[model samples]
Target: MDFDEAGKSLSLEKDEYIELVEFFFPAAEIDINKLMTANEKGDTELASDAAHSLKGAAGNLGFMELSDLARSIEERARNAQVTGLSLKIKELKDKIAIIEEAFEKHKNS
Candidate 1:
């Protein structure tokens, strides 16, 4: 939740970085849903696509934790390995929720 560091990496003001982060949340949630659905359907290729998209987006925004999680999922999917993906997806969701909560606290402060 180092917004200052993230803003520096992106060359954005704090408020601008926050704006992008706010925009990313819902879109990321959609991607997560797509990943979950794809996983349940055993669509590894589709899941990989979703995970790759999320990794790229998160990495670009300096959210490395999210990017790394997504990358792991992507790699597993690319290998056609669907084992324990539900647990990984849940972990990703938990991280996202924690980040969102921190962001809300930042807003209030």
Candidate 2:
């Protein structure tokens, strides 16, 4: 994905961008875990909070699709809509996997 080039084009310092990506990598995992726990415990508020947090972090890293998906999850959680959350979570995980792969490749490059 050429995150370095993307950062340059966006006027973000390379080191700053790398740090942001690193920060998000672990944060996303933690947030996803928390969201799953919240869902299992039927704690909609916590799930919403987790999803909201993920959305902000993803958006900051220019992960527009992830951010959008997170936003939808957050909204659904807030509304007590759990019917499709599982599917959404799976989709989000897949997206994160792709992003992680790109991050790893870019970092090594």
Which of the numbered candidates is closest to the native, going by highest TM-score? 1
Please give the clash total of every predicted structure, in order. 0, 0
Candidate whose lDDT is highest: 1
lDDT of each: 0.92, 0.90
**Steric clash pairs (candidate 2):** none
RMSD of 2: 1.3
Identify the runs in model 2 with alpha carbons over 4 angstroms from their true place. none
- Per residue, candidate 1 scores C-alpha lDDT tens digits across 1-109 of 8777888889999889989999989989999999999999999999999999999988989989999999999999999988999899899889889988988998888
- How many backbone clashes can be found in candidate 2? 0
Off by over 4 Å in 1: none
